[model samples]
Target: MRQAEKRAIERVASKRRNKNSSSSNDEFEAEHICIRTCGRELKCGKHRCQQMCHRGPCPSCLEAIFEEISCNCGRTVLQPPQPCGTRAPECRFDCTRPRPCGHPQVAHNCHPDDLACPKCPFLVEKGCICGKKTLKNQPCWFEEPRCGLVCGKKLKCGTHSCNKLCHRPGACEDEGISGSHCQQLCGKTRSCGHLDTERCHAPYPCKEDKPCQAKTFVTCECQHRKQEVKCSATKIEPSPQRPLLKCDDECLRLQRNARLASALNIDPQTHTNDHVPYSDTTLKLYRENPQWAHIYEREFRVFAEDRAEKRLRFKPMKAHQRAFIHSLAEDFGLDSESSDPEPHRHVCLFKTPRFVSSPMKTLAQCAKICASQDSSTQQATIANDATAIPYNALLLTNPQFGLTVEELDAALRKEYAAHPTVKFHTSFLPSDEVVLKGSGTWTSQTLEASLTALKSTLQHTVRRLKLAENVFLCSVDDSLNVLRREGGQAQREGGWSAVVGRSTGRIRMPRDR
Candidate 1:
């Protein structure tokens, strides 16, 4: 077939899929009308909900079909909920395609299709390569990476059209990311290697020829009060998910345009294009409009947090236990001379319990180093005189500014293995290094600061959960709280005093008590 003929044939092939072929699908579309005004029809963002017109106004249409359009000028308010089709005075035209105007939105003078503003100079179509109108859906990607062309429907990324994300048209830093170099040609490329591997493993594989032939299979559309983790600060109920309505018609195309319109809220800095700010209200409306399964925005956030943290934790689990010391040292920025984390002698016993002990020598040296270099890191109110080893001492060797259980294990090994004349009994090891030189090592000022840092960290983690203000962090051990919330804060409850013993900056073995 000729190129133009093939294009026509393909476009028709795409359009044919839009028609209502089955009663089940039609019923599904009828029951739930996804508000195009919400990010998009199909690809609703399952994240935080905020300022979308759908969440703000389109509540009625969630379960309702196209009824009427309503309008109200600033001077006169339209009281009654008019039909979805009922047009009014203030707005000149509805989306040319007859999409529901979710609310009395900030009315723009120009037509939805017109990329240009009424008389605004900002609507210069200087980068109109496709020669398409400069409306919202018809975004001028040529103009800038994050364009503001608002559409009345969803926007889709066909393997061909989505040259940027799906198949990255040109070569980036990524190898074999070129169209000619997909899995078939350059399986070594990162995208090809990882994404293709994922695709191959999928029960429904993407054919080598038609990589993007796979349709949108599963989507999470959430509604109801679902809790979510947000910004390491709060547990918020994120917006619901909007499942896409599969179609091949212009309506679907228009919905896709709408999806693109409400779809992205880009952070120019990180180059992360998140779904528009989602909220519980926005999500509920989104789910009602185009109902589908969702991880829910809040749930998605929580899911992501869990995923990231698990990823963070998984590294240590994956590595050899012998490398534990190096991993912790590298993770917490520990070095040999710094804490003399170098080498020491050891006395061992069976099964290093969940909590292990280290000599005061090591702890004292760590305190001195932290005090000398990054004195600001010296937290307040540490129980230096406590019979147990300080928790921060184990953390002094953390690669990532804070300490984790992995680091403790790593540090214990680091101290013991490096000791030239190490003596180990069975599983337990104790170091003989006189880490701190002077009687002045355990100071009121030093201990106080360390304790304060621990308190501060634990408090922060609890606060992020968005519980009551009175809620203070109480954990299996405040140390676990401290360990988990390092660089964060936790809350404490009424009349509940923290044992504040040896978990966080200090370690207490079975014998230490």
Candidate 2:
């Protein structure tokens, strides 16, 4: 009976146990729905889980999972464990709760006591305390206000707004709808029904707001005053009339007169009378007074008489003298050939006064008489001579005044040696004179040429020696016959001086006669 009673109790216990097991199974299945949907391993009651996993784990499961994983700070909260061999496993945990110092919860598994927690403040998820979304992850420990997201909207001035982000929590006094400080200084409605948003310090008045156009007086070019409308106060235009001085009739007349005077002054015709018109004045005088013509005629007759007298006085020997002078002038090429019948009254005037004193021979007479005398003397000398000598002689003045007779002889020898075709003899005469006698088989022309050559050589030698001033060379025959007088006293006289003294009426009377 006791055994039967125990069996009944056991069946009842077994039935109760199955009911509890089925109930627990339904609860476990309901909790595991998250894991099944996420297709992940169960994390519930795991020692590493700190936060409840939204996919699979619950708050209770996270509390139980991290129950034995104590942080170094003695906090029970810990991070979920990673696989053993995974790189950089986050095996540590942190208390993500808010702190009294306005920072995030301290981190676990840190070093020194001071470093037990992350000293920096936490960033608000939405934004910073200033409500700027751009402040995400920024340190909360910054004392000054922080500005982060840029405000890119347009300002009232029609220019771009300040690009600075919103200010920190306590920085701004007024905040706009964009969560930034209000910085708009323009964008106001005007009475003209226009949005005049320009931040202009000095506003311009419209045309309608300007004062009335002013009235002023302007002078015309004729000096007549006229009324003119001026520009508006806000506008600037050229003067209604140019600022010019109007001229009167008298002024214009003066200017015209001045221009006309200038033009007349510049005219060539006006200046044509600058020089004295003597010829024109004389012609006009003669034309005006015909009776005065006799005066000019009488004066011209006196001039002609005077000219004739002067001619006769200057040339006393007209018949033979004039003819002789003309012949000489012709020979010397001093006279021009012309058909004019008038005598050359100016010809044959004695250059020296002494020639006028005696019965002088004109150059033509002297040339003819001397030439005849030369021929006659040459014939007489050749005929009267006993020896049939073919020789010529030249008389020359010594070129070197200071040279000795020996030096002179040596020069003459040198000169003679240059001409091998001739034999020469040199002899000294009275005064500075030398005579050279040459014997050669030569004609008159060849003799002349040799004489010329000898004279030239002597001249050059004298010059090289820097000799005396005068060196005269003449044919011996011509000098003795034509130039010298017959007496021994006359031989001492030079040819030119004797001619001059004898012609000047200095003839000595014959004392015996």
Predicted structure with the largest TM-score when compared to the true one:
2
TM per candidate: 0.13, 0.18
What is the C-alpha local distance difference test score of each model?
A: 0.28, 0.42
> Model 2 — TM-score against the truth?
0.18
Assess candidate 2 and give its lDDT.
Answer: 0.42
lDDT of 1 by residue, 389-481 (tens): 332221121122222334334434433343323221111112110111111245534543443444444234324432112111111122222
- Model 2 agreement with the true structure over 273-384: per-residue lDDT tens digits: 2222123333333344435433532432343334222111122233343443343323222221111113323232211111111112222333345457679999778654
**Shift in Å, residue 310, candidate 1:** 13
- Model 1: CA > 4 A from native: 1-125, 131-161, 164-329, 332-513
RMSD of 2: 44.9
